[model samples]
Target chain A: MQNNWEKLNQELFTSSKRVIILSHRSPDGDSVGSSFGLYHFLKKFNHHVQVITPDPVPPFIHWIPEFETAINYEKQKDESFDAIRAADIIFCLDFNTPSRMGNMEFAFDRRSKDAYVINIDHHQQPDNFAHFQISDTSASSTAQLIFDFIIKTKGKTALDAQIAQCLYAGILTDTGSFRFSSTSPHTHRVVADLLETGIDVNAIYQKIYDNYSQDRIKLLGFALKDKLKLYPEYHTAIIDLSEKELNSFQFQKGDTEGIVNFPLSISWVKMSVLLTQKDGIVKMSFRSKGNFSVNELARNHFNGGGHENASGGMSTLSMQETLKQLESILPDYKQKLDESKI
Target chain B: MQNNWEKLNQELFTSSKRVIILSHRSPDGDSVGSSFGLYHFLKKFNHHVQVITPDPVPPFIHWIPEFETAINYEKQKDESFDAIRAADIIFCLDFNTPSRMGNMEFAFDRRSKDAYVINIDHHQQPDNFAHFQISDTSASSTAQLIFDFIIKTKGKTALDAQIAQCLYAGILTDTGSFRFSSTSPHTHRVVADLLETGIDVNAIYQKIYDNYSQDRIKLLGFALKDKLKLYPEYHTAIIDLSEKELNSFQFQKGDTEGIVNFPLSISWVKMSVLLTQKDGIVKMSFRSKGNFSVNELARNHFNGGGHENASGGMSTLSMQETLKQLESILPDYKQKLDESKI
Candidate 1:
C-alpha cells in the first residue's frame, strides 16, 4: 500500500471524486485561499468539492468565489456535518493543532476513522494524526504549498484565471502584500507563475484590497481623532475603540482591519496597541518593533500569544482594563528601548 | 568656473561654515529624509545645517530628528530666506520641476544664480536648468541616490546611525513600507546597508507605519465605509471624500494616505480612485491594474498624468462635478474590460 497522498494524487485523474476541504477556525487568507484555490483546481476534473469553515469568514474576504459555496458548519447543522462524513478525502489546511480547528475539531476527529485526512499547513509543530503531513515553515502560506501540490499531483502545466486569482490572494494576504519577512524568492516565482495565467493582477489586487464601507472609514476617523494615545517616553502608542463608538459607526465585523498600524507611526514609538470590542469581549492586538516581544506581552498579560513582533490577546475586561494592564508593564521595557535607540 | 553644483559641493565641504538644506513643496519621504539625513551627516563636520520644507511636515513623519528644525517658508518670512540666500550650497532634492519647490521656488531661482545648485532627483525628464544633475530614475528614491552620492563624496565605506535612519525613511515611505512595485534588489541592498549602521529597522517601521491618530483612523474608517463606490462592469472603484465630510471628521492633512487601496478589493474592479479636498481644490489619484490606463484617464480627463498603472490628477470642480466627469468616461472603458475577460 502506497502512502495515502501518493496513492490519491497518482489516481486523482482517474478515480478521485467527491473531495471536501476544511480550514482552521477564523480562516485566514492563506487557509481560505488555499482551500478554495484547490477547490477550483479539482472542479476542472469534474469533482464535487465543498469548502467548509467553522465560523463565518471575514467580511472583507467575501469577494472569493469559493466563499460563496462555503458551508457554514454552525448554520448548516445537518448538511455540512453530513457532507463531511460522506467525503472520501478530507483536506485540512493551515492548522497544526486540534484546538485551533474550532468546532470542526469534533467532526474531524469522528471522520478520521473512515476518511483519509490530508494535512497541508505552514504552522509549527503539527500533530502526528494526519495520513499525509506536508508542512513547510519556510513557505509563506499554505496556499503556496497547495499551488505546488496541485502542480506536482496533477502534473498539469495549465492554470486558469480562477486558479490564478485564488493563488494570488493566498500569496498576497499571507505576506502582507509581500512586505513581510517571510516573502522569499520562491514566493516571487509562485506569483510570477500565477501572473503568467493572464489573470488580471490589477483586478485581483483591486478586488482583494480596495472595497471598503463608508462607515468603516468613519470609524477609522473617529479612532485617529479621539482614541489614539501616545507615550513618547516609553516609545509606545495605543488606540482604544470603545464598544459605543464601534456601534455608532455601524461596526461591521472586519472594520478594525489595518487600524493598528496607525499608532506605530509616532517617532520612537516601538509598541502599538489596538483594543477593540467584539461581542462584549475586548480584543487587543499588539504590534511591536525590535525586541519588544509582543508575543511575550500577550502571553503574560492577556489570554493570547502569537509571533514575536505581531500578536494578539483576548480579555473579558473592558477597554480601560486592557489599557491599564498594558501600561503597567511599560516601565519594564523602557531601559531596553533607550539602550537600542536607532 | 566649474558649474555651480561641483563648485558648491566643493565649497560645502571646504569653506562652508554653515548651511541650511531644504526640499521642495509637499515634501515626500525621499526629499525630507534625504535632506535631514544629509543635515545629520554635515553636522558631524560642525556645519550649521537645518532641514526646511515649504509645507508642514505631518506629525506622522516626526520620527526624523531634523523634522523639528524644518522651517516653514511662510512663517519665517525674511529671516530664513536670507539664510538660504547666504548659503554657499543648496541641495534641491527629489524635485525636477520648479513649481514643486512651492513658495520657495522664487527664492531658489534668485539666490541660486550665485550659489551652487545640485539637483538630486529620481524623477524622469530632469530640467536642464540645474547646474549639476545627478538624477537616476531607475533608483527607488532620491534618498538612495543621495546615499550613493554621500559615499562617493565623503570617501567613506560606512554610514552613521543618523544617516541610516534618514535613508531608511526615504526607502520606507517611497516604497509604501516596501510593498510598492518600485522595490528592487538594489533597494533591498540599500536597506541592508542601512541596517549595518545599527539602525533599528523594527523601530523605524513602527514609527513610520504603526503610529496613527484616532482621528485619522476614524477618517480612514469614514472614507472606506461610506465614500467608497465600485463599478464592476467598468472595473472601476472610487473613494470620494468631500470637504464637508473632511471637516466633520476633524480631518487633518495626510489622513487619507493608503486609503485608496481599500476600495480596490471588489473582484473584477481593475481601476481605483481616491478623490479628496485639499486647500479648496479637488485632487484625484488613479491606480489601475492589467492594461487599464489610469495615466491616460488622469491626463486626458483630469489634466494630469503619471505612469501607466499608478497616476494622479487634479480638478477645481466640487466632488459632485468630478463624479459626473468620471461617469461620463467610465462607460467607454466597459468594452475594453469585457474583451480582456478572456
Candidate 2:
C-alpha cells in the first residue's frame, strides 16, 4: 500500500499549495474525520486547506475541532466550488469515486485540470480519478489510512492532539466503537497511537454519542415502545414513525439517527428497518446482520442501494403504506434472512 | 510495577508446579477471562493448572476453550476445594481481597498455608493477602495485567490464541468493549498484540455479546417500553420488573445484565437503576456516570456497596415499597446527581 506515496513528501508537500479536501455526501464520521484530519495535518505544511463536504455533517460531530470551517456544498455552494476550482492538490477522502462527491462532482471534472488528485479510502473498487491513491478495503476506516500516511511520511511526531482526535473519531465511529467486524489489530494500534497523543477518549465518545437532547432520547423511547414492529417469522424488525409522532417529540434533524440499529441487536434478527414520515415523504433506513444483503433488498424493492448489511431508500407513501409495503416484500427474502448469521 | 517480579520466572516458575486460579464470586467476563487466561498460559509451561470459580460463568462465555474444565464452587465444591488445597501456587485474579471469594474465603485461609499466593487484580485497595502481588487500579482489566505479567516474564512467544481469547474477553467486558474510561493506550496495544496471536475478533465478540437469546432481547424491549421510568428532574431513570413481568418473558440468569446501563446512554441521566422481583426479594442494580457514587447510595440506602459508578443491593420489601423508598431518597441526591458529569 505504501508504494510511491513517498512522492507526497518529496514532491507535492515541499511547496505551499492550494489544497481542498473533498468527502462524500451526507458526511459521516469517517468523511468528516478523515477530511478534517488531513486538512489539519496539511495546514502544518503551510498549505491553504479547505474541507469541502457534499452536505452538512451530523450534529453529533459538531464538537470536532474546526468542524465549523467545513464548507457544506449543499448549503455553501459558491465557497465550496471556489475552493475546488482553485485547488493545486485535491485530496478525495473516505469515498472512492467523484460521483460520491454528489454536487461537487462537476467542479472536480470541469475546473480542476491543473490539480493533482489523491484518493485515500477504504472502500472497494477504484477508478482512474486520482493521480495518487491508496485503496485498502481491509482497513477499518480512512482515518487509519491517514494515520499510516502521516506516519509513513513524517513519522508519529507529526501528530498532535487535534490531528489524533479527528482521526480517532473517524476510526471509532466507522468501527462502531471497535465492535464491527472490520476492526483489526492495526486499527487498535492506530487508536493506541492516537491515545498516546493525549486525546480525551471519553469526551470524544460522549460528544459523538451522548450529545443528543432529552427530546431526542424520549422520541427514541416512544419509538421503541410504540412504533417498533417485529416480524419474527421473517427474522425482521421495523420502527415506523409518523409525522405526528415526530412532532410529539419536537423532533429535530439527526435526532432519530441510530434508532434503526436497535433492532439489529436481537440475535435472530437478520434485517431491521426504520421509516420516518416527514415533508410528504417517508425516508427509509435498512440494516442487516451477516450476509442478508440489505443492499440487494433495498435496491430491488425500495429504489436504493448501499453496502450488503446497511442501505437507504425513500417512499412517496404514507407511513402506513410504507410499513405495509415493507412487510409485503419480506417473505421473498425470508429464506435468505433465516440463513444469515450474526 | 515490575519490582522483583523476576522471581516469578527465575525461582517460582523454573519447574512445573500445581497452580490453581481463583476469581471473584458470580464470575463476570473479567473474572473468568483472567483466570482462564492465566490457566491456559500456565499450562503451556507444563504446570498442572485448575481454574476454580465461585460460580458458573455466564452462558455467553461458555464458548471459551476448555471452559468446560472450569470448576464451579457453587456446583462442584469438592472439586474446587480439592484443587484449592492441593495448590503449590495460587493466582488470585480480578478481585483484590480474599473476601471477594465469598464462600471460598475460609478454604483459602485454612487450607492454602504453603501456597504462594499471587494476587493479580485491577481493583482498588487490595488487602495484604498475597506474598507476590500486582494491583494496578489503572489497568483496563486483570487480563491486561496478566498480558503484561506474561510478556514481562516469558516474552510474547508464550501466548497462543486460546490465552489471547480469554484475555481479550476480560478486557472487552471490563472496559465495556473499550468504551469505558479505564481503557488506556496500553489497553489497545494489549488487544493489538492479542489479535496478532490470530484470534478471531468477530467470533469472540459475537460469542460474548450476540450470544443472547431472543427472549432476553424481547424482555429488554418490554422493559424499555413498559417499565423504563425517567425522572429528568433528578437526572435519574429506573426500570423495575415485577415477578409477573419477568414470568411473561421467561427471565433467565444474566438476561438483565446490561439493562441497567441503557439509560446511562441518555445525556443528562447521571444514574440508572434496575430492580427485579424474585422469590420475595427485590434485587437492585445501580449505575451512575461521573462521581455521584452509586456505591455510597447502594451502601447507605440499599444495604449494598460496589464501585462508585456501579453497585448492587437488595430489598426485602415489596417491589412497590422498594421503588417508593428508592424514589423518596432521590430528593436528597438531587443536587449530587445534577452535579455529576457524564
Candidate 3:
C-alpha cells in the first residue's frame, strides 16, 4: 500500500533541487523532529535544503541537532518567504490543513502552488493541498511516518544518529514517552532500529522533559494548586489560567503545553480541560481517557476538533462565560463520561 | 565474559526447581522489575517461582504484571520466610550486600547457606556472597543484565511481552526515562529488543511515570514554591520538606523520590540536595552534574554513598541544624563545585 507513495517520494528526491520543509505553527516535537529528520536525510543527497517553522521551537526542544538553523517565519518573515518561494519541493509536515500554518499560510499557499508540495502527517481529515500525500492517522507520530518515508525512499542504512535522534524525539514526545494507545509494536521496533544508530535516548529525554525553568515549574505548582477545578459527578477536571496569571510567571510559548494532561492523571477523572486566555480569545485543550469523544464535543460546541481522545477548541467569550458554557454542556456528556470511568 | 555466567545460569536452570527472588529493602523499579522479569522468564520453564521484597512495592509501580503475587516480607512475613526456606535457588537482584535486604537478610542468610545464590545487580562494590555473580556497574539497570541473562540462558525466543515490559520499566525508571549517562547504546539496543516483544511501550511509560496521585503533584508544587532554597555561590539548590508539610499532603513512601533531581534542571546549578524529615532523622538525597562527586560528599559529610552523580545520606540533626550543617559544608566544596561547572 505504501509502495505507491514510496515511488512518488523516491522520484521527487532523485535530483538535488532546492527544498524547504515547513511544519505547522506552534511546532511541537513531532513537527520539528519530522522536519529535521527529513532535512538531514535530504541533505545527504546534496539538495539545498532549508527547514522552516511558522514560529520558534520551544526552549525544551532546542537541544535537537541543527535546530538553530531552522527559520522561524514569525521572526524572519522575509527569509522564510524567500525560502518558500525558491524551493522546488516543499515538505509540509505534522499538519494537514493550510489554516494550521497560521500567519505563514498566505506565503505557503502562494509559493507552494507551483512547487511539488508533499504532505506527510498523522492528523485526521487531511486537506488536499499537497500534490503527494502520505497520511496515516494510526501512526504514533509524523516522525514515525517520516522514518518510514526515509526507509522506503533511501533505505534503512541512510538513518544516522542525527536523523534517528530527531525521529526518536518526535515519536517519544508525540506518544507521551510511548504511553498513548497510538503506539504499536511496530513503533517500538522503529525505536529499536533508531537506537541501533547510537543516538543517546537519555540525553534526548532530558532535553525534552527535564529542561524546564524554575519559573515553569513554579507556574505549574500555581496552576495545580490555585486554578484547578474538579466536578467528580461528570468525571471532569479543568484548570483555567488567565493571561494575568501567565504574565506573572513570564510564560514562554510552550510553558503550558502539557498542563492539560496533568488532570487526566486522577483515577476518577476521565475528561481533562485546560482553558488559557491567549491574545484576545481563550484557547482550550481537551483530553479524555477511554471512548469519550472530546473531538465531537470540541467541534460541535467550541469550533475546533482533533483526535478522538484529545482535541482543541476556542472561546471568544469571557473566562466566566466560557466556564458557564462548559458547565452547561457537562449534562450532555454525563452518560459518556460515567461509562468511560475506570 | 558474560558467557561464563550464562553457562552457570543455564546449568542451574536445567531442572524445574523452587526459585525465590529477593530484592533489597524499599524496592524500587530496578529491584522490582528485575525480580519480576526473571520470575516471568523462569515461569516459562515451569519453575516454582515466588518474588519477595522486604517492603511493599510503591503504588506507582503496582501496574507491573504479576506484581500482586510478589510477597512483601514486611506484611506477609510467614509466607516470605517459608518461601526462602523452601527455595532451591535465590536470585538476589539490584543490591550490593545482604544488609540491603533489611530484616529479610537474616532469613536469606539462614536459608541460602545450602541453596544456590545468584547475584544479578548493577550497584557498586557488590559483596561476595553469591555462588555466581553477574555484577556489572556499567549496566544501566539490573533489569538489563537480567535480559542478557535470559537471552544467554534460554535464548532470545524466551522473551515475551510480559517479561519485556518488566525489563523495560526497570531500564526506563532507573535511567530516569533514558536521561542518565548510564544509558549506553547497548542499553537502548536491549530496550529495542524488549519492544520487539510486542510490549506496549506507551502503556508501560504511563504505568511508571503518569500514575502519580493528585497528592504527589500537590506535594511537588509545595516543594518547588515554598520549600526551595538556593546557594548561588556554590551553584547549589536545596528543597527541604518538613514532616508537617508532608503530613499535610498525606505523603506516601515514594512521593518525594525525584524531587531532588528537579533542581538539577537549572542550567547554572551544579548540585542539588533534598532534605526530608522522616522518622527521627533528616533524610538527604544528593545529585550533581558534570565531574562533581556527590557520592564522595555524601560519604564524608552526610554518612552515605552511592553513585558518582547521585547518592543518599542522613543526618540526625533537626531541620534547622541540618540546614546549618549543609550550609557550613558548602564553603569546603566551593572550589570543587566551581571547577566542575559546565
TM-scores for chain B, in order?
Answer: 0.90, 0.97, 0.93
In the range A1-342, model 1's lDDT, one tens digit per residue, is 125665666545667577889888887777788988999988888788999988878765677775789987877757777888888878888888767877877777767356777888888877776777787888889988988888777654747768877877888898776656566556666776676665555445556565556566556656765677778788877888888889898887777888887666544667888999877799989887666678887898888899877899988987887789788888987887666433
Winner on DockQ between 1 and 3 is 3
Best candidate per TM-score, number?
2
lDDT for B141 (candidate 3) = 98
Report the number of clashing residue pairs per model.
54, 0, 4
lDDT of 1 by residue, B1-342 (tens): 134545655776775455667687777777888888888877777777766677677766787975777787767757668877787667778887777778887776667356666678888777865667777888778888888877877754546888888987987788665555555545656665676676655456556665556556667756655666767677777889888888887877787877876554444667889999877799998876567777887999899997777788999987889888988888877876666431
lDDT string, candidate 2, B1-342, tens digits? 344666666545789998888889898988888888888888888888888888777888887789988888888888778888888998889888898999988678766678888899989888877878898999999999999989988899999999999999999999987878898999999999999998877778777887556677667767776688889999999999999888887888988889898777778888999999999899999998778899999999999989998999999999999999999999999989878866
Q: Which candidate is the best by DockQ?
A: 2
lDDT (tens digit, per residue) of candidate 3 on B37-126 = 999998987899999999878887888888888889999988888889888889899998999999999889779456878899998888
Give the poorly placed runs of model 2, Cα more than 4 Å off. A1-7, A10-12, A222-233, A317-331, B1-7, B10-12
Mark the regions of model 1 whose C-alpha exceeds 4 Å error after superposition. A1-5, A333-342, B1-342
What TM-score does model 1 achieve against the real structure? 0.64
Give the poorly placed runs of model 3, Cα more than 4 Å off. A1-14, A112-114, B1-14, B76-79, B184-186, B192-198
Q: What is model 1's C-alpha RMSD?
A: 8.2
The local distance difference test score of each candidate is 0.75, 0.86, 0.85
Residue A222 of model 1: what lDDT? 67
